[model samples]
Target: MNKITIFHNPRCGKSRETLKLIQEKVSDDDIEVVKYLEDVPSEEELKNILTMLGVKAGELVRKNEKIWKDNFKGKDFSEDGLIKVMVENPKLIERPIVIKDGKAVIGRPPEQVYSIL
Candidate 1:
Protein backbone atom coordinates (compact mmCIF):
# COMPACT_ATOMS: atom_id res chain seq x y z
CA MET A 1 0.00 0.00 0.00
CA ASN A 2 1.11 3.52 -0.68
CA LYS A 3 1.83 5.93 2.15
CA ILE A 4 -0.94 8.49 2.68
CA THR A 5 -0.64 11.97 4.10
CA ILE A 6 -3.37 14.48 4.76
CA PHE A 7 -2.79 18.19 5.19
CA HIS A 8 -5.50 18.67 7.74
CA ASN A 9 -6.81 21.70 9.53
CA PRO A 10 -8.72 20.42 12.54
CA ARG A 11 -10.86 23.54 12.90
CA CYS A 12 -12.55 22.95 9.58
CA GLY A 13 -15.45 20.52 9.53
CA LYS A 14 -14.68 19.39 6.01
CA SER A 15 -11.09 18.71 6.94
CA ARG A 16 -12.20 16.70 9.96
CA GLU A 17 -14.62 14.67 7.86
CA THR A 18 -11.87 13.92 5.37
CA LEU A 19 -9.63 12.77 8.19
CA LYS A 20 -12.36 10.49 9.54
CA LEU A 21 -12.94 9.03 6.12
CA ILE A 22 -9.25 8.34 5.70
CA GLN A 23 -9.16 6.68 9.11
CA GLU A 24 -12.03 4.43 8.12
CA LYS A 25 -10.60 3.54 4.74
CA VAL A 26 -6.88 3.37 5.42
CA SER A 27 -4.83 1.70 8.11
CA ASP A 28 -3.67 4.04 10.86
CA ASP A 29 -0.04 3.30 10.17
CA ASP A 30 -0.42 4.07 6.46
CA ILE A 31 -1.90 7.50 7.08
CA GLU A 32 -0.15 10.55 8.39
CA VAL A 33 -2.04 13.62 9.54
CA VAL A 34 -0.35 16.96 9.27
CA LYS A 35 -1.87 19.74 11.30
CA TYR A 36 -1.00 22.28 8.65
CA LEU A 37 -1.48 25.48 10.60
CA GLU A 38 1.17 24.51 13.09
CA ASP A 39 3.39 22.76 10.63
CA VAL A 40 3.10 24.77 7.43
CA PRO A 41 4.33 23.36 4.14
CA SER A 42 7.33 25.13 2.69
CA GLU A 43 7.26 26.78 -0.73
CA GLU A 44 9.03 23.80 -2.30
CA GLU A 45 6.61 21.41 -0.66
CA LEU A 46 3.64 23.44 -1.86
CA LYS A 47 5.11 23.46 -5.38
CA ASN A 48 5.45 19.68 -5.29
CA ILE A 49 1.91 19.31 -4.01
CA LEU A 50 0.62 21.56 -6.79
CA THR A 51 2.35 19.34 -9.32
CA MET A 52 0.88 16.24 -7.73
CA LEU A 53 -2.54 17.82 -7.73
CA GLY A 54 -2.22 18.72 -11.40
CA VAL A 55 -3.34 22.23 -10.59
CA LYS A 56 -1.98 25.73 -10.88
CA ALA A 57 -0.80 27.40 -7.71
CA GLY A 58 -3.85 29.63 -7.67
CA GLU A 59 -6.16 26.63 -7.89
CA LEU A 60 -4.89 25.31 -4.56
CA VAL A 61 -5.83 28.50 -2.78
CA ARG A 62 -8.89 29.10 -0.64
CA LYS A 63 -9.96 32.42 -2.02
CA ASN A 64 -12.85 32.65 0.39
CA GLU A 65 -10.54 32.94 3.33
CA LYS A 66 -10.26 36.40 4.87
CA ILE A 67 -6.55 36.40 4.27
CA TRP A 68 -7.07 35.97 0.57
CA LYS A 69 -10.00 38.37 0.42
CA ASP A 70 -8.22 41.06 2.31
CA ASN A 71 -4.79 40.56 0.83
CA PHE A 72 -5.05 38.92 -2.52
CA LYS A 73 -8.50 39.26 -3.95
CA GLY A 74 -8.62 40.99 -7.33
CA LYS A 75 -4.85 41.01 -7.39
CA ASP A 76 -3.03 39.40 -10.25
CA PHE A 77 -0.16 37.22 -9.13
CA SER A 78 2.39 35.22 -11.02
CA GLU A 79 2.36 31.46 -10.46
CA ASP A 80 5.42 31.59 -8.28
CA GLY A 81 4.04 34.62 -6.45
CA LEU A 82 0.83 32.79 -5.66
CA ILE A 83 2.76 29.78 -4.43
CA LYS A 84 4.89 32.05 -2.27
CA VAL A 85 1.79 33.71 -0.81
CA MET A 86 0.19 30.37 0.04
CA VAL A 87 3.42 29.26 1.68
CA GLU A 88 3.52 32.47 3.71
CA ASN A 89 -0.16 32.23 4.59
CA PRO A 90 -1.21 28.67 5.14
CA LYS A 91 -4.77 29.75 5.92
CA LEU A 92 -5.20 30.41 2.24
CA ILE A 93 -4.47 26.75 1.44
CA GLU A 94 -7.43 24.55 0.68
CA ARG A 95 -8.14 22.09 3.45
CA PRO A 96 -7.79 18.34 3.65
CA ILE A 97 -5.35 17.83 0.79
CA VAL A 98 -4.63 14.12 0.68
CA ILE A 99 -1.48 12.86 -0.98
CA LYS A 100 -0.78 9.26 -1.92
CA ASP A 101 1.59 7.61 -4.36
CA GLY A 102 2.65 10.96 -5.85
CA LYS A 103 -0.90 12.05 -6.55
CA ALA A 104 -2.92 14.56 -4.56
CA VAL A 105 -6.50 15.71 -4.27
CA ILE A 106 -8.25 18.43 -2.37
CA GLY A 107 -10.71 16.74 -0.05
CA ARG A 108 -13.35 19.43 -0.28
CA PRO A 109 -16.18 16.91 -0.55
CA PRO A 110 -13.90 14.59 1.47
CA GLU A 111 -14.69 11.68 -0.85
CA GLN A 112 -12.42 13.18 -3.49
CA VAL A 113 -9.46 11.67 -1.68
CA TYR A 114 -10.74 8.20 -2.46
CA SER A 115 -9.70 8.43 -6.08
CA ILE A 116 -6.07 9.08 -5.21
CA LEU A 117 -6.06 6.21 -2.73
Candidate 2:
Protein backbone atom coordinates (compact mmCIF):
# COMPACT_ATOMS: atom_id res chain seq x y z
CA MET A 1 0.00 0.00 0.00
CA ASN A 2 1.08 3.55 -0.67
CA LYS A 3 2.32 5.62 2.27
CA ILE A 4 -0.15 8.29 3.31
CA THR A 5 1.46 11.53 4.47
CA ILE A 6 -0.34 14.17 6.45
CA PHE A 7 0.98 17.66 7.13
CA HIS A 8 -0.62 17.85 10.51
CA ASN A 9 -1.02 20.36 13.27
CA PRO A 10 -1.85 18.64 16.52
CA ARG A 11 -3.42 21.81 17.92
CA CYS A 12 -5.83 22.28 15.04
CA GLY A 13 -9.19 20.57 15.40
CA LYS A 14 -9.54 20.02 11.66
CA SER A 15 -6.08 18.59 11.45
CA ARG A 16 -6.74 16.25 14.35
CA GLU A 17 -10.01 15.16 12.77
CA THR A 18 -8.32 14.56 9.44
CA LEU A 19 -5.67 12.40 11.06
CA LYS A 20 -8.35 10.37 12.80
CA LEU A 21 -10.15 9.85 9.51
CA ILE A 22 -6.91 8.80 7.87
CA GLN A 23 -6.24 6.39 10.68
CA GLU A 24 -9.67 4.84 10.11
CA LYS A 25 -8.72 4.22 6.48
CA VAL A 26 -5.12 3.13 7.05
CA SER A 27 -2.98 1.70 9.80
CA ASP A 28 -0.73 3.89 11.92
CA ASP A 29 2.37 2.20 10.51
CA ASP A 30 1.41 3.37 7.05
CA ILE A 31 0.86 6.95 8.03
CA GLU A 32 3.53 9.66 7.93
CA VAL A 33 2.47 12.56 10.06
CA VAL A 34 4.50 15.71 9.54
CA LYS A 35 4.05 18.40 12.12
CA TYR A 36 4.87 21.04 9.56
CA LEU A 37 5.15 23.91 12.02
CA GLU A 38 7.94 22.17 13.87
CA ASP A 39 9.42 20.43 10.86
CA VAL A 40 9.05 22.91 8.11
CA PRO A 41 9.32 21.87 4.47
CA SER A 42 12.00 23.32 2.23
CA GLU A 43 11.25 25.45 -0.79
CA GLU A 44 11.60 22.53 -3.18
CA GLU A 45 9.41 20.34 -1.02
CA LEU A 46 6.83 23.11 -0.80
CA LYS A 47 6.91 23.44 -4.58
CA ASN A 48 6.36 19.70 -4.99
CA ILE A 49 3.42 19.84 -2.59
CA LEU A 50 1.98 22.75 -4.55
CA THR A 51 2.23 20.71 -7.73
CA MET A 52 0.56 17.77 -6.07
CA LEU A 53 -2.15 20.08 -4.73
CA GLY A 54 -2.57 21.71 -8.16
CA VAL A 55 -2.46 25.17 -6.64
CA LYS A 56 -0.20 28.17 -6.59
CA ALA A 57 2.08 28.96 -3.64
CA GLY A 58 -0.29 31.65 -2.47
CA GLU A 59 -3.20 29.28 -2.63
CA LEU A 60 -1.55 27.10 0.00
CA VAL A 61 -1.23 30.04 2.37
CA ARG A 62 -3.57 30.77 5.24
CA LYS A 63 -4.06 34.45 4.55
CA ASN A 64 -6.20 34.88 7.61
CA GLU A 65 -3.31 34.06 9.89
CA LYS A 66 -2.06 36.93 12.02
CA ILE A 67 1.38 36.61 10.54
CA TRP A 68 0.01 37.24 7.09
CA LYS A 69 -2.31 40.00 8.16
CA ASP A 70 0.33 41.77 10.23
CA ASN A 71 3.23 41.39 7.83
CA PHE A 72 2.34 40.10 4.41
CA LYS A 73 -1.10 41.50 3.85
CA GLY A 74 -1.36 44.31 1.29
CA LYS A 75 2.05 43.37 0.03
CA ASP A 76 2.87 42.42 -3.55
CA PHE A 77 4.84 39.21 -3.54
CA SER A 78 5.89 36.96 -6.36
CA GLU A 79 5.18 33.24 -6.24
CA ASP A 80 8.68 32.52 -5.04
CA GLY A 81 8.42 35.28 -2.47
CA LEU A 82 5.20 33.77 -1.10
CA ILE A 83 6.90 30.42 -0.87
CA LYS A 84 9.76 32.02 1.01
CA VAL A 85 7.34 33.68 3.38
CA MET A 86 5.66 30.38 4.10
CA VAL A 87 9.03 28.74 4.65
CA GLU A 88 10.00 31.41 7.11
CA ASN A 89 6.60 31.31 8.81
CA PRO A 90 5.22 27.83 8.71
CA LYS A 91 2.11 28.98 10.53
CA LEU A 92 1.00 30.58 7.29
CA ILE A 93 0.85 27.28 5.52
CA GLU A 94 -2.54 25.66 5.51
CA ARG A 95 -3.18 22.71 7.77
CA PRO A 96 -3.86 19.02 7.39
CA ILE A 97 -2.58 18.52 3.88
CA VAL A 98 -2.98 14.84 3.13
CA ILE A 99 -0.98 13.19 0.38
CA LYS A 100 -1.19 9.78 -1.26
CA ASP A 101 0.35 8.61 -4.52
CA GLY A 102 1.68 12.06 -5.37
CA LYS A 103 -1.73 13.68 -4.97
CA ALA A 104 -2.65 16.07 -2.16
CA VAL A 105 -5.75 17.51 -0.59
CA ILE A 106 -6.16 20.23 2.01
CA GLY A 107 -8.39 18.76 4.71
CA ARG A 108 -10.17 21.96 5.61
CA PRO A 109 -13.46 20.21 6.36
CA PRO A 110 -11.53 17.05 7.32
CA GLU A 111 -13.81 15.01 5.02
CA GLN A 112 -11.96 16.44 2.04
CA VAL A 113 -9.26 13.88 2.73
CA TYR A 114 -11.67 11.13 1.68
CA SER A 115 -11.46 12.08 -1.98
CA ILE A 116 -7.75 11.29 -2.06
CA LEU A 117 -7.93 8.27 0.16
Candidate 2 lDDT over residue span 34-92, tens digit each: 99999999999999999999999988889999889999899999999999999999999
Error of 2 at 109 (Å): 1.1
Residue 47 miss distance in model 2 (angstroms): 0.2
What are the runs in model 1 whose C-alpha is more than 4 Å off? none
TM-score of each: 0.95, 0.98
**Can you write out model 1's per-residue Cα lDDT over 6-87, one digit (the tens) per residue?**
9999899999999898899889999989998899999899999999999999888898888888989999999999988988
Prediction 1 TM-score vs. true: 0.95
Q: What lDDT does the true structure give each of the candidates?
A: 0.91, 0.95
Model 1, residue 10: distance off in Å is 0.5
Roughly what TM-score does model 2 have, to 2 decimal places?
0.98
